[model samples]
Target: MAQAKKQSSIKVKVQKFGTALSGMIMPNIGAIIAWGLTAAFFMYPHGWFPNKEINNLVNPMLRFLLPLLIGYTGGKMVDDDRGAVAGAIGTLGVIVGTDQPMFLGAMIMGPLSAWLLKKLDQVFQDKIKSGFEMIYNNFSLGILGMIMAIFAYFIIGPVMEVGSQWASAGVNAIIRVHLLPLANIIIEPAKVLFLNNAIGNGILVPLGIQQAAQVGKSVLFLMESNPGPGLGILLAFTLFGKGKSKSSAPGAAIIEFFGGVHEIYFPYVLMKPSLILAAIGGGVTGTFLFTTLGGGLKAAASPGSILAILLVSAKDAYFGNIVGVLGAAVVSFIIAAIILKHDKSTGEDLDAKQKEMQAMKAESKGQAMPEAEDAHESVKSYENVKKVIFACDAGMGSSAMGASLLRDKFKKAGIDVSVTNTAVRNLKDEDGLLVVTQEELADRSLQKTPHAMHVAVGNFLSSPKYDTIVASFKALTQVEDKPKQEKPVKKVGSIDGIDFSKVKEVNFIRHDQHLGTATMATSLFSDAMKKAGKTTPVKAVRINELTDDPSHLVIVTPAANKNLAVRYSDIQTLVVKNLLQDKKLNEAVEKLN
Candidate 1:
C-alpha cells in the first residue's frame, strides 16, 4: 500500500508538471495556427500564393511573438499579470541571442522569473511603509525583471539552443534508423495518461517548428497530432464493444476525428487497458507510413483533427498523410475488433472497469472509496447551486464534453442551473457553486473551491454521478413546484438545552471526512426552511470555526454532538438521527425567532 501510494503520488506530480508545461503552450495554439496558415499561404517560394511582403509575418511570429506569448502565459500561471510582464521580459533576453526560437527557454525562465518575483514581494511588501508603496512595488518588479532577463540572456539562451540541437538530432537519428514508428510504444500510452499536450506542445512543436523553418515541413508535427489511433479505438468500440462503451463511441469518434479533441477517446482506452495495444498499433503504423511515404505537415496541427492536419500539410505530402491516417485506422480497427470478439465478458464488464478506475482515482486523490448507491436516494440536497462547472487539467476537450453532457441533462430535467467548463487552475471559490472534476483532478478542484460542493467522476462522458446529480435536482424541483398543504408553525413552549429566541444562525459541523456531506446537509436544511418561509441563515463550518455564542445553533449527529460538548458550552446544539434528513429540523426551524 505504501509503495502504491508513493507511485501514485509521483505519477500525480509528473502529470501536474506536464499540465503546467502544456498549459503555457495550449493557450498559444491559435497564434501557432495563424503562423502556419500565413506561411502556407504567402511564403515567398513555397507558399501557395508566393507573396514575399505578407510572408514576413511568418518567421517573426514563430521567433518572437509565439515564444513571448508562451512566456507571458507561463508566468501568469505562476503569479498573475505582474508575473506575465516579468516572464515576457525574461523571454526577450533568451530570444535576442539565439537564431533558434526560445520556446524551451520561455518555458523555464517565465515561471522561474515570476516565482522569484512573488517570493521577493512576500518578503519585502510588508516592510514598505506609507505613501512610498507604489515606489517599492514598481522598483522591485523592474529591478527583478531586468536581473532575470540578463540571467536568461547569459545562461538560458545558449543552454536551450544546445538542448534544441540535441533533441532535433535525436529525432533525425531515429528517423534515419527507420525506428521512428516504435516511438508510439511510449507515445500512445502517454496520450492515454493525459500527457498528450505535454508531448505534442512541450516537446514536439518546438522541434517541428525548427525543422519546418529549414525544410518547409516536418513529420514531428504529425507524430502526436494524428487522430488515427484514437479514431481507430473509438471505431472498434462502436462495432464490437458492449454497453455504454459501444453506444457512446460514434459520438466520441466524431469528436476525436473532426473536432480534434483527442481526449474524447481516452476514457474508452482506460475502460479496457489492453485496448492500448490497438492505439500503439495504429500509432506505429501511421508513423511508419508517414516516414516511408514522406508524409509531413508544414506546421503543428493544434487538435490533430483531420481537417486541421490536411490544412497544414506540405503541398506535396498530402498523399502520404492521407494514406498514413487511413492505414492507421484500418490496422487499429482490425486489432481492436479481434480483441473485443475474443473477450467473453458480459455487458457489466464496462461497469466493473469503471468501478476499478474510480477506485484508483479516489485513492490517488486520497478521497474515500466510492460505495455503490442510487443517485436518486443518496444525494441529500439541491439548493443554491446556481451553476455547475466541469474542470480538468487543460480545460479544453474532456471537461467541455462533460459540461455539454450535463447541460443536456439539465435541459431535459428543466433545471435552471448554468453549466460551464474551465481549467482546474482557473477555478475560484464561489457561493452556490458545484464543481465536477475527473477523480484524479478532484483534490485540486476541492482545494480551489473548498466551500463549494464537489463531485469526482471517473469517466467524464458517462459517469453515473451525472445521473445522480440530475435525479437529485429533478426530485427537488418537483418537490418545490408541487402543491403542498400549508402546516401551522408549531409553537414550542420549551425544549431541553435550547433557547429558541437566541437562535440567529444554524450550522452543520464539517470535519475533514464529512465536509461534502455536511455541505449538502446545510443546503438541504436551508432549502427546507426556505420552503417553510423562514429566513434564518444556515452554514456549513468546521467545529473550530464555530463561535461559542448562544445565538448560533449547531446541528450534529449523536457522535458529533458528543464531540461538540467537549469543546463548547455557550452554543445551543441539536442531536439528530440523520444530519441531512432529520424530522426534528423542521421543528427547530419553526421555533426559531
Candidate 2:
C-alpha cells in the first residue's frame, strides 16, 4: 500500500502538470484560433486581409494574453481568483522579459506563483486581526504578486529565453538537414505516453512562434499537432481490431480526427505496443512530407484537427499541409492494420495497456513503478458504493467515455448503480463515491476527495478491470433500512398483519442517503427474522437502486421517500421507520419471515 501510494503520488504530479499546461491552452483555444487566423491572413504580406496592425496583435497575444490566461487557469486550480491574478502577473513578467512566448514557463510559473499566495493565505488568513483582514488580504496579494513578477523577470523569464534559442536552433538544424522525420522516433511514443500537450505547448509552440515571427510561418507547429498518427491508429482499430476495440474504434476515430480529441485514441495504441510503430510511421511520413513540400501552419492548431490545420495554414501551404496529414494517416493505417491483423491476441491486452499507462506515468514522474498486484486494485466494499466516477484532467473527453463504458458494464450485469465522470479538480469527497482516475492523475484526484474511494486505471478506454469492478459493486450486500415511525404489534410467533412466506428478498429502504446505519439496522432485522423462523433473504438497497420488481419486499423507513410506492406501484412497501429500535426491528424482521 505504501509503495502503491508513493507511485500514485508521482503519477499525480506529472498528470497534474500536464493538466495545468492543457488548462493554459484548451480553454483559451479560441484565442489560439483567432491568432492563427490573424497570422495566416492579416499578418502576411499580400495575404487576404493583410494589415500590419493585426500582425502587431500576434506576438503580444502569444507572449502575454494566452500565457497569462493559462496561468490564471493553473493558479485557479491551486487556489482561486487571487491565485489567478498572481499567476497572470508573474506570467506577464516572463512575457515582458522574453521575446519567446514562454508557453511552458507561463503554465508552470503562473501556477507556482499562485500556489505560493494560496499557501500564505492558508497560513496567515486566520492569524490576521479581524479589523485588519481586508488590509492584510489586499497587501499580502499585492506584495506577493510584485515579488513573483520580479522573480519571473529576473529568473524564469530570461532563463526560458536562452532555452528557447537553443531549442529553436536545434529544431532549425533538424529542419535544414531534412532529418525532421527523425523527430517522430521520440514524438510518436511520447504522444502516446500522454506527453502530447507538453511537447506541443512547451517545445513546439515556442519554436513555432519564433519561426513564424521570423518568416511568417513554421512547420514546427505541425510536428505533433498534425493529428494524422492518432487518426491512423484509431482507423486501424476500427478495421482490424477484435472484441470491444472493433466496436469502439470507429466513433473514437471520428472524435479524435474531427473532434480533435487526440487522447481518445491513445489507449488503442497503448493496447498493442506494436501499434506504436504504426504511429511512428505515420508521424515520420507526415513530418517528412511537410518539410519536403514546405508545408507549415502560421500558428499552432491547438487540437490538431485537419480543418484547424488548413485554417491556420499559409495560403500556399494549405494543400500541402492537408496532403501531409492525409499521407501520414494512410501510412499509419496500413502499418497498424498489418500489425493488428497478423498479430495474435494475447488475451492480456488489457493488462498490457494498464501496465503501459502506469509505467509511462511512473517514468514521467521519475519514480519506481508500483507492483502489478498493487495497481488498479478495487476499493474496499466497492460493491456497496453508491456511485463510480471516472475523472481526467479535463472532465469532458476521456472521463465521459470511461464513464459510459463502465455504465454499460454495470447495465449488462443487471446492476442499478450510478456511474459518471468529471474533471478531477471538480471532485468532492462525498460518502460512498468511488473515483476512478487515470494512473497519472490518481493522486491528484485522491487529494481532492480523501474520503471517497479511488481506483487508478492505466487507460480509461481499455482497462479490463471494469468487469471486476462492476462485480464488486454486485457483491455489496443488497441491504436497506427504514426508521421506526410506529409501534411493533406482537403476534403469536408471527407479525399480525404481514405475510412473511410471500417474500424472498427483504429490501431495507433508507429515507435519504445510506451511510451504513440503515444497513446495520436491516441486518439486525434480518437476524431477528431468522430467530422468528423466516427463511426469506433480507437485503439492503439504496433508495436510488430500488426497482419496481413486484416480488421483492421493500421496507420503507421513517421520513422515507413517498415516491418509492409511486414509482414501484406494483410492489408493496412497508413503512417501518427507525428499524434500529429492537421492538420495531424484531417486528419488521418477523414480517419478512
Candidate 3:
C-alpha cells in the first residue's frame, strides 16, 4: 500500500511538472504564427507579398504584447505572480536571443524562462523559503525581475541583432546566387505551408490599408494582382470534390479565396492530410505561375485568397492574376483528384469512425445530463450565498492582478463581492468560486468543482475582458464586504551552518547540479543569496561541500537531499514539510506563523 501510494504521488508530481512545462511552451503558438506573418508581409508587397507598413504596425504590438500575454497565461497556470513576472522577463531574453522580431524570440523565451524559474523554485524552495516570501511580498521580486529585463536588453539584445543581420544576409545571398528559381518554387509551397501567415498579415494588410485610401481602385486592383492559395484550394475542390462535398466546395472556395478567410479550407484538408501535399504542389506551381506572369500588388495580402488578391492588386495585373488563379486551380484539382481517388476507402472509414465517436460522446453526455445539471445548480447557489473566490494556477501574479481588477470593477458597480486569489485546488464550497483562467486550465478546476461556472477568459486578467465580467457581476449584485486581512508574513528557520541571526531573508539559486549547468546555477544561487536582506553579509557554499556543522543547512536537489535536512528535529518541522513540495511554498510560509 505504501509503495503504491509513493508511486502514485510521484506520478502526480511528474504529471504536474510536465503540465507546467507544456503550459510554458504552448501559449507561444499564436505569437510565432503572428511573427511569421509579420516577417513575410514586411519582405513581400505584391498581392501575394508583404510590405514595410505591415512591419511597422505589427512589430511593436507583437514585441510587447505577445510576451506579456504568454507570461500572463504562464503565470496564471502556476498561480504565481512572481513566476508570471519571471516569464515576462525571460520572454524579453528570448526576443533578444532571436534574429527574428522580439515577438518571435519572446514566444520561444517566455516559456523557457517560466520553466527555468519554476525548476529553480522547486530545487531551492526549502532552502530559501523565507527569502522567496520576503522578496515577493516586499516588491523585491519586481527589482530582481528588472535585473532580468536589463540582462535581456544589453546581453541578449546585441547577440540577436548581430546574428539576425548575418542570417538575413546569408539567406538573401543563397536565394540570389544558388536558388533563384528554387526560391520561387519554394515560395508557393512555403507560402501555403509556412508563408501563408506572412501573406495574410504582411502582404495583404498593408495593401488593403493602402487600397483603403482609394477604395474602389485598390479593391479592383487587388482582385487581379494576387490570387493566393485559396484560389488553388478552390480549384482543387471544384475539380475533385464529390457528391455533397462538391456542392460545399464552391462556398468554401469563395470564403477562402475572395472572402479572405483561409481557415475555410482547413477542414477539407484536415479530412485528408494528403491533400496538404497536393496543396503544397499546387501552391508551388501557382507561385511560379504568378511570378512568371508578373502578377503583383502594391500591398500585403490579407487572406491570400483569390478574391482578396484580385481586390488588392493593380488594374494592369488583373489579367495575370486571373491566369495565375486559374493555373493554380487547375494544378491543385488534378493533384487532389489523383491522390484522393486512390484513398476513397480510407476517407469513408474516417468519416464513419468520426460519426461513431460523435454518437458515443452524445450517448455518454446524455447519461450524465442530470449530474451535470445538479453540479451547475449547486455552484450557482453557492455563488449566490458564499464568498466569491477567484483562482488561477499561481495565486499571485495574474490572478492577484486579475482579482484586484475585478474587485475594483465590482466596487465601482456597487456589487457586494469578496475576491481573493488562490490556487485552483484550494477552492472550497464555502468560498463560492468562479475561476477566471486561460482556456487550457478550465479542466483542472472544473473537475473539482463540476458546477462552477468557468469563464474561459483567455488571458482575461491582462485585457479589459476581466473588467467586462466584473461589470456584469456588479450589475447583478448590490452587497459588498469589508476587505479581507492581509496575508501574514512567514518567519525564517535557524539552520546551523546558515546564520539567520544576522540574516533577515534567504535567497535560492536553482540549477541542475548533476548536469553541466552547475556553474550557471552556482552563479544564480550566489547572486540571489547575496541579495537577501541581512545586517551582515554571508557567503554561500554548495550543499555537497558543506561541513557537518550543527548550524549549517545543506541545499541540494530534492531527489538526493530529501533525507538530509529532514533528519534535523530543531529545523522548524512545519517549514521542512512546506519546502518538500514546490507548489506548497506560499502555504509553507503561511504555516510559519
Which candidate number maximizes TM-score?
1
lDDT of 2 at 3: 71
Q: Tell me each candidate's RMSD, in Å, in order.
A: 12.5, 13.9, 16.2
Give one digit per residue, the lDDT tens place, for model 1 in 1-593.
56777876676677777878888988998888788888888999888999989988888998999899999998999877778888998998999968897888899989998999989977985565423444666688899999998988889998998998898788889988889999899999998877788788878887888888777889989889999988988899889888778898898889889988887787777767788999999999999999889999888898889999999998889999999999889888988888888878754566667666666666655665433233355544456677899998779888998999999999988888899999887887766778888766665676677867777766677777788888788777456445779985632212455787898998888654775677678778878888888898887666866777788899888788778876665688888878877768778877875
lDDT of each: 0.82, 0.73, 0.46
- What overall lDDT, based on C-alpha atoms, would model 1 receive against the true structure? 0.82
**In model 2, what lDDT does residue 490 have?**
44
Ordering by lDDT: 1, 2, 3
Give the clash count for each candidate: 0, 18, 40
TM-score: the better of candidates 2 and 3? 2
True lDDT of residue 306, candidate 2: 80
- Alpha-carbon shift of residue 508 in model 1 (angstroms): 33
lDDT of 3 at 259: 57
Residue 408 C-alpha lDDT in model 2: 89
lDDT of 3: 0.46
Error of 3 at 53 (Å): 14
Cα RMSD of predicted structure 2: 13.9
